[model samples]
Target: MKAADDSYVRVAVLVMLSLSLLAGICATLIHWLGPVHRPMDLIVPPVGSAIFGGLIVALWRRPWWLQGIVRLALVTAVLALVAPAWFYTLQAVSTPGVQLIVVLPPVSSLFVVLLVMVMIFIPGRLAFVLALLCWLLIALPVLAYLLLHPREAWTPRGIDLLMAYGPVSLIVVVLLPVQRGMAGTIRRLASERARMEVMLHRDPLTGIHNRRLGERVLRGVFDGARSAGVIMLDVDRFKAINDTHGHPIGDRVLQAVAERCKALLRADECISRWGGEEFLVIVPDIDAAGLHLVAERLQMAIARLPVAPVRQVTASFGATMIDGADSFDSVLQRVDRALYAAKEQGGNRVVLMPVRPAAAGALASG
Candidate 1:
């Protein structure tokens, strides 16, 4: 099913643009084998999309440029399909009674594009059932026209639109149900797999990436970037909060801080819950000094949020960037040590680890 009516209109435009080019060319080749080329054929080719294209333009109110292109392409397709019949209509041999032959028109090509539209844009049983109804609707008209006017419908230089084209459309629509069912099953499976993957990575209590997954993600980021900030964060006096507010309230506080940190993590950030009351984060572009800025930002985000029934909550953060070509593992170890130092000094304060003598001096000042 279409997500909305606007989406249906866009899909219709794309379908017309894609299938018309291919089907129009095919129709041109097939009808050339017929006889009796005519002025009408040169003028109109084989008007398939014209009817439906016009319908979309009127119903959807598609953009003027798209409508213009649709009108032009549909006209071109009709002209291409009918081009072969230009001469024969004028050269009809007179009969004692009138030498007559049987033929169908060139409505087959239109049916082909319409079938593709149903397959691509529409979903489920509706696509198949509606397509079947349309097939019969278009098929009968071509069939009747071919039956009534055999000489015109099927000539050596002409089209046998109904008799030749009708059955092909009916068969296509009949096949749609199976194809639609298969596609639905595949999409559902893929969506479910993705949902499960997300569940596996998450900590159920805190809704944060679990330690293993978070570590994996941060390691990848640190390895990929030339410079990055590794920050360790812990909820301030989390034990005291748990003791005073109860474990349920403590869980809520942890959940709130996790959400704040997650929001702070941009496209190049990876953050996860390292353990109870602790979180780990990696920011790809930050240097040692820039790491301090990032640490401060996380501190603010944690402190700013309004968690219901918990008036005052804050997080202490410690950050360090790799000093001169250190391995990702060493960088993490250094940063995590710095985090412990911050907790020892005072709760709710940001601490920075010195990667070099200059950084050490800056940390003392901080």
Candidate 2:
């Protein structure tokens, strides 16, 4: 999650830097083409563009000082607007009969951009704190000047700038914490939902899929008319092991068996704890030969598994392939019968059951 957040921040920073560079180029172009050109426009835009370009390159390289660099860039952007507003305001004060509305820079709209950047890039209380500081630095002077010139403050442009810098900025800062709280709530709920889903589908003892999930997967296979191999496995003499070494040792044995079996299966395959000392495996897209081979491998793996304080551990496997016309119950019944046959045959062996003739007819008809 931290890596994802860092990635988001990097992308946002790059976008912001690119926009700043573009803004500088546009400002320079406007000054160059306009009938009246100012020395400050030529000097500031080119210099600021150079700074923005350098920051863009630095962000692309991604050094250890990237966080400090972002902070610096944000500060520079804010100052670019704030300095102009202050300068024009000071100039207006000195000149008599100067129409403040026409002469004053429209820096209030740009301040909104800086405020949004602060809110997005900065975290926790610091963001609001920075916002307050920004309001003070940018709005305070204009507000004081307006208060002094009451007639100008009541004008359309004056009122617009006043509301923008004052109430509008305040509302944005005040509502942000509430927005952050709601976002945090959403994240927590999503995380909790994922955890509950895991608990629902997973067996508590073996940390494998539960019977419910296994049945669901089997049902999906049947619904899709796909071929799959089902292996019903039972730990041989599980009750005897529990009686001799206690339930704790038996649990450990089950866990080890589950781990080993899971390791052997493909990512598309699933193994579930079907019941006590029993597991159900679903391997998709397998033929009868491949299914039998898989069952043999699982049997050998269990036979070779060494659980401490036990001489040896083994499991019996009953393997069968899906018939196209088989229902969930019918397939499970076939696997269960095969498992019973394996138990009867001295256990710890793979038993394969062929598809029923009626089911094969159903398949052929379909």
Estimate candidate 1's RMSD in Å. Answer: 6.6
Q: What's the count of clashing pairs in each model shown?
A: 32, 0
lDDT of 2 at 105: 49
Error of 2 at 153 (Å): 2.5
Residue 184 displacement (Å), model 2: 0.8
Name the best candidate (by TM-score).
2
Worst 10 residues of 1 by lDDT: 86-95
What lDDT does the true structure give each of the candidates?
0.64, 0.84
Model 2: per-residue Cα lDDT over 1-366, one tens digit each: 567667877888889989989988888788788786756656677788899999988888865556987898888887787776777677779889875677654567768888878887788889988988888888888888898998889999999888988888888787777787898898789889989999999999999999999988988897775689899999999999999999999999999999999999999999999999999999999998899888888888888998988889988878788988777888889888888888888888888877873444211000
Question: lDDT by residue for model 1 over 114-168, one digit each (tens)?
Answer: 6655655556676666566555554444444446656656664225354344566
